[model samples]
Target: MNRSSFRSVLYLAAILPFFFSDCKKSSSGPASGSGGNGYYTRFKMNGSSVEYDSQPFAGITLLKSDSLYTCVMVAYKDVNAGLKNAVTIIIYSANPIAANVGYNDPLKSRRSNGIMVPQTTIFWYDSTGTGYLTAGEFADNTGNTGIAGVIANAKLTITEMTSASVKGTFSGTVYRSDLARSAAITDGEFYLKRSQ
Candidate 1:
């Protein structure tokens, strides 16, 4: 397979397990005083709101490199009718992450380990099939078209970070390369605990 295709496959392989794995619940509940079962991801896409709450498994993880740290937060709804979907937010930094900080630059091409980071570097996926992300070379199952949010128009900010949970907000634009269609993502917010 070509490089881009290979990267796409690798990305899928890494996250696919989260969809199928029988994850154990964390001992602690949602961040203290955060409210609502302590786990939720909600946002608006193209003016419509898409929300998921009380996910069976959702949390933030820290990936450490020599001197860099990537905070990855993932939230997904249980598979319904065999469809798999989720949203992921990754924050890369040279130092420990803090609240009120924004990560990812829209003006620069986002790459990690030689792979293009998902739209906004924060991504949303649905199995029903849509073609977005032409600029980033992301394609759908058919390999002909795909969809990805725009990094240049995207931003994610950590609103709160505590020992038990993390809260954040994000916004961006997503594009379908095949149709030249675009959608706005606004009022995105999430609260999750440290992945166990």
Candidate 2:
């Protein structure tokens, strides 16, 4: 074959593999997260809400891919409603804001210390409108627990989602416990990125 024809054929051979490879990747679901360093967050129970020494801690984690993410901020309360101190797991979904994305943990309330009181649930929301939480409670405390006015469930409101403009407050009435009485969680922000 002529030199020009030979070179043209060679170029096509090299380009075919790349085109097919890209097509295969794009057809699949969204690319995975960046598995980057997880986010940090904290909170305290208010009024009549006593927190245990362990269990129901809040934090974030990076997934494998390098794009998505997951996180949780649990406030565990240990109360003796009856025979068992019900265990509560309050879950939150990290939403994306200002280019930031939201993520949820794969596991919830996995413990061994045994729940002391009926688990109460709460969901936190922000102005970002990027994510929301699914809340549920375990009220096996017997005697209707007589309504403790506990944090039960809290809604987080913010004027803006940006770090500089992010300003809000956390208010609630915890039934009874060894925790602080009414606290304002105004620190600790979770930062996420694609997992490389």
Candidate 3:
């Protein structure tokens, strides 16, 4: 990730939730979308699920249900210790139903009313020529609560296959409840590259 890109991630870690949530309407105005009578109306997504070399990446997913639009993102690093390979999907719409969509929702974890899981996975790279990182499973919860964790199998898979010119580096600060943990993604990226 370039310095600008890292900055962008840090920015998203702060305000992207608006883009991910029902905070704004899909059209016609700024933050004017409505989640009318329904069981949908979710909150936010993390990655864009873009396809480059026949693969998905660390991205935010946009999911719209009976009445809402939600976003989901999955990313993690820390490969060697096998301790930070976790995925957190957060969902929160301005609607009551959307309130159910979140990672690690104590009330909704085992219930079916909160998360909408389809078929998807995402991969992200710490930097160009640094190796690739992947996340699995899906975790959901509301922002008010703690984000849950997905049981993922992560690894660093980059070895003399691509040109460094096209690959990139990653940087960004995280917004954790505890500011001390603000370097979440950075820690992940560094670990991914070092392990391989």
Best model per TM-score: 1
Please estimate how well model 3 matches the true structure, expressed as its whole-model Cα lDDT: 0.25
The model with the greatest lDDT is 1
| Candidates sorted by lDDT, best first | 1, 2, 3
Give Cα distance to truth, residue 154, candidate 3, Å: 12
TM-score of 2: 0.23
Q: Give Cα-based local distance difference scores for all models.
A: 0.53, 0.26, 0.25
Could you give the candidate ranking by TM-score, starting with the highest? 1, 2, 3
1-196 in candidate 3: lDDT tens per residue?
2334334433344333223332212334322111221111111124322111111012223234333333343223221211122232333232322211222211222213544332222223332212222122222322221223322222121111121111112222223322222222321221111100
Question: In candidate 1, what are the lDDT values of residues 1-196, reduced to their tens digit?
Answer: 2446634643653464354344434436652222366577788877888875534233333443333455666565543312245565655555567788776443222244544343235556555534232222343222332233332455778888887778888876554433346667789898776554
Residue pair clashes in candidate 1 = 106-152, 131-146, 131-147, 132-146, 132-147, 132-148, 133-148
lDDT of 2 by residue, 1-196 (tens): 2334323432332232232221122323323211122321234433223322212233234323322232223321221111122112232332322222211222123223442321222232222211121211222223222224322333333222433222222332322122223233222232211111
For candidate 1, what is the TM-score? 0.63
The local lDDT score (0 to 100) that residue 68 gets in candidate 1 is 43
- Stretches of candidate 3 off by over 4 Å are 1-68, 72-102, 105-123, 129-150, 153-196
Candidate with better TM-score, 1 vs 2: 1
